[model samples]
Every structure is written in structure tokens, then in C-alpha cells.
Target: MASSPTELPIHRFNSFDGVELAYREMGEGRPLVLIHGYFSTAMVNWVRYGHAGKIADRGYRVIMPDLRGHGDSARPHDPAAYPHDALADDGFALIEHLGLTDYDLGGYSLGGRTAMRMLARGAKPGRAIVAGMGLDGILNTAGRGGYFRRVLTNLGSFERGTPEWLTEAFLKTVQGDPVALLNVLDTFADTPREAVEAIAMPVLIVAGKDDDDNGSAEALADLLPHGRHGVIPGNHMSAVTRPELGIAIAEFLSE
Candidate 1:
């Protein structure tokens, strides 16, 4: 039987920027790195959902990283510390630290955008998966970014039923660092259309049918040189936990 995420041990590493990062490795075979979304830890996004286990059982080694300021990584609240490419840099740095090549890579939401940006920055993975993200969000993060800024700046002070309120609740649910996350929002990556198109790789774009937050996953997939769109059960918040999401990702990477 493949080892479950809970059964796997946690390890730590230092990124190029000197921030401490935590990660977990499970199963053994071809390497696949999965980055957890914003306001989430690797365990919550991948392990709790059984996504990591499912992928590992499919004969692939899974490496799940806790993004800076999330999970067990360092929280740098200084705005200047959070660069546009900081998240992607952490991912590619992890790959380089491991001396890996031709490995599979991807992420969800923030992680998805990071994966896309990493690819644009020349981290060539054998296969790629972008989940819970759309094209426009990657190209122009200002709108969504501004929303987060408002939530954090006011500390989720909006009235109930408002987007700001919901966002703040979600942020609290994950126990995120207020200042650090504010910077994450401020320095979100902006990957241009041309940069995305230059990736001559098999890319899987996973989206929740009801998720219109980032935009349409199908539309984003159409922009890739070799992109395939996948629909999974649940909205952005619930989709990560659905087994269907894991199934789609495994099938795509294995092919």
C-alpha cells in the first residue's frame, strides 16, 4: 500500500531567498511537485483531500510544498520581501535544490498561478497542471489582488454576505499571517499571454464547473500550446477536496 500523507514525515529546506520552507514527500516513482493554494498548507490542500495519496498511488513520487507565509514556512510581512515571482521562485528553487529534471509540476489557485509563472520563468517540467485558476487572473492580478488588499487592510471588516467578509473568513479559517498575506496579495505574479504561450508542454488546466473567480479554465487551456481543460466537482473552496479533482490530475499527468 502507498503511504498516506499523514504517515509521511515532514522535511525542511531553504529557498534561494533564505526563507525556510516545509515539504512532504510520498510514494516513489516519477517525481511530481504539488504546490498548495493560498491561505492553505500542503497538508490541508493535498493530503487532507487525498489528492497527494491518489497521485502517489498512481506510481508517482509526490512532493508537496508549504508556500512561504503559509503552512510551516517563514512569514515575511515586509512588502518589499514579497516579489511578484517570489512564490514561483520558491518552487523552482525547491526543484533545483533536489537536482531534479523533467519532473511533473503544478498547483491550485495561487499555486496554479505560481506553477504557470514558474514555467514562464524557464522551469521546464515534463507535465504541468494548473487547477482552480483562470487566464485573466494570471495576466492581470490587480483586481483580485486589490480585493485581498482590502480584506487584509481592513482585516476582513466587511459586512456579512460581502466578498470581503467571505474572504476574511476564509483567511481566518486557514490561520494566515495578516501582514505576510497582504504582501502576497500585493506582489502577486503577472504572467503575460506570450510567456504562457511559449510553454511547449502538456498542460492540464483544472477548474471547478461553478468557479468563475479567476475566469474560465477552458478559456485558459485554449491559450496554451498543448493545454487540456478539465472540469471537476465543487466550487473553488470545495473543489480541492473532491476526489474527481485528483482523478483528473492523475490521469492527465500519467498520460
Candidate 2:
């Protein structure tokens, strides 16, 4: 029996470190694990904009996981909970837990960086999509992570209409835990240039034409042995909301 698109049930699993993590699934077919961006949950990044359904309808088992500090996943205030490459660690655990020997993986923004780390760390997916991420974003996460650290540390200090203020507003909307999120920042580690160059799998470096929040998407794609760049309609924030993002992903995967 085929599952309804709306019936996204959150499933819980214990990661390697015994911290409980959560994920949601849709459709039924080859697995496609999607990691949502920072400050956003699986629902917000993949489901809210219909990206998951769009891909799932094309015959994929869309697995969306809320990272350790975000969404329904357990948020641990203890700094020890988030070791180096924490997100990638959880991602590896998810793949192992699901017994997925053959699967597809992709992520957006922070999630995208996580995907890169996962690949560098050797979790091979049939095809990988690094959306809304660039070479600099993956190679030097502190600059971006620092921006969020500021937002989390000084929530009320931002004035209206500023980027910092907007980030705070989004954090408030999501009810993100500042303490845990700060720890998540500690999980950020720079990916080596050789590691990025060594990824042999076909990769789609999709990004919004107006989005250069991290760095140059094309440059990142150029570095990969089998990387291809796909352009979508909007900026980083707005691009995920557009149908073009999913369309690009689905098309790339189909090819």
C-alpha cells in the first residue's frame, strides 16, 4: 500500500552516543535522506515547501531527519554531546540504523555542509546534492557559524530589518534552543580541499542564483570530480521555498 503524502510520522532512534534523534518519512521506494538547513526542521526545509513530496512522488522514500539540536531531535545542553563533526556522526548513525547500503543523500545550507562532511567521512550515496552551499562554506564554517553564535548569544540585541534581527525572528519562530544550537556550532569543522576534490560520486551543486551566503557554488562544483551546478530561482532563504529547488533536485537524481 502506498503511503499518503500527509502522513509523515516522526520516528525516533538512539544515535551512537545514546542521544535520541528523530526523523520523518514519506513515500516508498529507494531511500533519499535529506538533512534540513540550520535553524530549520525537516518539516520546514523539506516538507513545508513541498520539496519532499515533489521528490517522493517521483518514487523515492524521502527520509528527513531533524539534526540533534533542531526539530524533534533531542537537544542536549552538555557540550560533550556535540563532538567534532557531530551532524555527520548522526547522519552516519541514521544510515546505519536504517540499514541503508544503497541510498541518496542531500542537504541544504548547514545540512548541505553536513552532507559534504558525510561524503568526506565516507558515507557513500548513489548521488549527492549539496544545495545552498559553497566551497568556502564547507572549508570554513566558523565564519557562518560565528554569525549564528552571535544571533544565539544576543537574541534581543538586533534591530528590525537587519539580517541578524531576521535570523533571531526565524529562531523564535522555530523555538530553537540557543544553548544546544551554540553547541551545534562547535560541531562545525572545515572540510579539507583534498577531501572535496576526492569525492568521486556525481554531485549536483544546486544553489539559488541570488544566493552567495557562503561562497561560490560554481567554484565548489568545479572542485568536485563529478560535480554539476544547478541554478534555481531564489536566494538561499527563498530558494528552498520555490518549486524550482525540488525540480532541480528531482531532475538531477533522475539523470
Candidate 3:
């Protein structure tokens, strides 16, 4: 049986910018940090999917944090402040605050992007996994820019223009200021190609076989300096939910 949320060990740390961040710690070996995507909270992204327990079973200490402006963390309403660099800084702050010097890191979707940003900034994790995201920073720049513009244009027409399913999903996952999502999307547009190429650590890039928006998992593998690729049998969201996928991640990180 999965551990109940109340049963998991949770911790809080203060960022350099004074934001209070909440994180969950599990297992008991080499430390590993798990970052969730945009809109999704750490509990939903990591815990709900059973990744937390699997990592724990591997004898790896897992640290899952709710990024600032998401979940239990402080949500600042200023969209201009939620840049990728800032997100990377937040990860560094959490790791440093926890006194972890050589841990592993993994992220899904938006969190995966943040992981890439951390690598860009010279974060030296023992190993890393960038799941459900690709390293096409230049290509993503154009795609995300167009996507955010369309979202912004539709926000005012929320009731009439947005699909019911999408609205429901957004409402369920987004716990922070609405603008924070847009801001992060905007910041994603400016991610440089050089940054993607600068990552020197061994990286595992996992993507869904059906994830069309970010190109093929093979393509992402080709871009990394030391990247290995794996394909899970599902779409973007399903890739995060599947237990087998998490096991694959645990095995790779262990090696």
C-alpha cells in the first residue's frame, strides 16, 4: 500500500529571496530531488504516482518540493519574477538549505525544464533525469511563445472560450496566482540553445512515445552531451502517472 500523505515526512526551507518552500522527504540512501511540472503539485506529481515510495524502496532518499507559486509554497503574484533562472535558483536554495552536496535530480514537464536550467547554471548533481521534456530550447522558444500568447488571449474568455475539461484540469492543478503560469510560459520562451548544450552531466531523457508537442524522445537524446533516452507507452500526462516509468527512472538513477 502507498504511504498516506500525512504519513510522509515533510520539511520547510527558506529561499534566499525569503520564500518559504515545502518539500517531502522519503527513503534512506543517496539523496535525490524530484521536481514537478507546471500546475501540478509535488504530492500529485510524485506521491500520487507512486514514484516517492519506489525511490524509497531503492534505498534512495527522495526530496520532493512544491515549487514557489505552486502547492504549499508561497505564491508571489508578479508574473515577471517567475523566470527559469529564478526557478533554478529556488532548486539550488532548497538543496543547499537541506545540506545535500551531491544528490541526484529528476523532474517532469515544467519541472524537467527547471532541471535543465539548473544544469545550465552549473548544478552538479550525481546524476539527473529530465523526463517528459526535451532539450530543444531554441525550438521551444518559438513554440512556447506562441502557446502563451494564445493562452493569454483566451484567459478573459475563460467561461466561453476554454474547454471544460481543460478548465477543470487547470483549476485542479494550479494552486497559485493564475498569472504565475503565464509568466513561467513566457520565461520558457527565452531559454537559450547554448544553455541546453552546456549540460555536462550524464542525463536520462524520458518521454512518452505519444508526446508530439516536444518532438521524439530520440530527438531529445540526440541533443544532450551525455543523454540516454527511454520511451514510456503513453502520452505526456500518462507518462507521469505510470508506475513502470518510475521504476525505469529508479533503475537508471541507481546505475
Candidate 4:
């Protein structure tokens, strides 16, 4: 039986550098590692919106991780804790810890970017899903990374109704740590075009109809050898909260 949203158990393990990371699991079957977005956790991105339940109900063991510096994971203040592609390193560590040799991988926004990093670094998930991300997001992380840096650096100053203000509001809603999140920014790495082209696994590049926040998802899909683009209703933020996102993912993975 699939676990109810509220019944999901939180699991912990040490990351590569001894940093404690957190993850939640539901259902039982072929493993599917689901990574959450920046300033978000497994609960908010997956469980709260019923995504995990929906995916799990489709016969998958949904493994959702709280990326370091976010959620219940260890938030190390030491700058040394965050190296280049630290989140990807943590993902690799999670795979090793769980011994996931023949599973699927997916993520949203930062999570999506991290999934790409993992694939580029040689993770061999049978299939992959990259949601709420686009070609620009993968090829050049600094544009979005720097935008978030400004938001964190100038938290309360943004005027209402502005994008920055909206982001800060979400940050407050999630109770994010500005300092640790800032450090996590150091881990962002630009994926080479060759890296993107080299990913031979079937990849579903799904994004919100109105989400061009990172770039063109269609373009990204076109670039991949076995990529396909799907659009759900809503923008980047709103789309994640919709059932359409989960439905699209379940449908694609089923195919």
C-alpha cells in the first residue's frame, strides 16, 4: 500500500562530507528519485501537493530528498561545506547509500538542474524527468543563481507585486536560511552543451505553459537525443502546485 501523505517517514543519512541529508519514501516498486526545487523541500514540493502520492500510486517508490541547506537536511554554515556541484555530489551520495542501480530520476527547478548534473556525472537511471527547467537553466546557471543571490541579499526591500518580492515571500513561507542557501549557490555549475547532448536516456522536459523563467523547455527537449517536451498549466511556481505536473510525469514514465 502506498503511504498516505502525512504518514511518510523521514529518513536521514550522511552526505559525502558527513553532512546529514534527509529523504522521504512512499509506495513500493521501481524506485524513482524525486528532487525538489530551490528553497523547497520534499514535503512542500512533492508530498504537500499530492505529487508523491500520485506518483507512488502509479507503482513507484518515490524517494524525495531535502537538498542540503534546505528542509530537514543539514545546513552547514562553513563555506568549505559547499563545493562546486555540491548538490550533485549529495545526489550521488544518496544513490550510493540507497544502492539505486536501476531506477528513475527526476526533479523540479533546482532539483531538475541537479538531476541533470547527476546524469552528466554518470547516473544511469532508466529514465529521467526534468521539470520547471529549460536549456538556459542547464547551460548557464549563473543567470538564475545570481537572481536568487540578489533576492537573498536584499530580502525585505523588494516592493510588493514584484517578482523579487514574490520570491522573498516564498522564502519566508518556507523558512529558508539565507546564509546557507547563499553558500549552496557556490555549488552551481554550468552544463556544457556536449553534456546535454550526451545524455542518451529518455528525458521528459516538462514545464509550465507560462514558465520561461529559465528559458525554453521546448528547445531543451529538441536538444536531447531522446527528449520530449510537455506543458502543464501555470507558471514555474504555480505549476508545481498543480496536479497536472504529477499527472504529466506519471503518464510519461508509464509510457
Best by TM-score: 4
Per-candidate TM vs. native? 0.95, 0.97, 0.86, 0.98
Q: After superposition, how far is residue 160 of candidate 3 from its true place, in Å?
A: 10
lDDT of 3 by residue, 1-255 (tens): 225655776578888778788988777899999999776888888888788788888889888999877788877777656664677888999988988897899898878878877877788997888888765533465664455456544655556544434644564455545665556564563456666667788888888888655556666667778889988878876778888778878999878
Candidate 2: which stretches are off by over 4 Å? Answer: 1-6
- Each model's total of backbone clashes: 0, 0, 0, 0
Q: In model 1, which runs have C-alpha deviations exceeding 4 angstroms?
A: 1-4
Q: Which 10-residue window in model 4 sums to the lowest lDDT?
A: 1-10
Q: Identify the runs in model 3 with alpha carbons over 4 angstroms from their true place.
A: 1-3, 137-139, 145-149, 152-168, 173-176, 186-191
Clashing pairs in 2: none
Between prediction 2 and prediction 4, the one with superior lDDT is: 4
For candidate 4, the lDDT comes to 0.94
lDDT winner:
4
Give one digit per residue, the lDDT tens place, for model 2 in 1-255: 326545677899999899999999988899999999999999999988889888988999989999998999999999999999989999999999999999999999999999999999998899999999998999999889888988888989989999999988889889999899999999998999999999999999999999999999999999999999988888888898999999899888888
Stronger candidate by lDDT (3 vs 4): 4
**Candidate 1, after superposition: displacement of residue 69 in Å?**
0.9
* Whole-model lDDT per candidate: 0.86, 0.92, 0.75, 0.94
Off by more than 4 A, model 4: 1-3
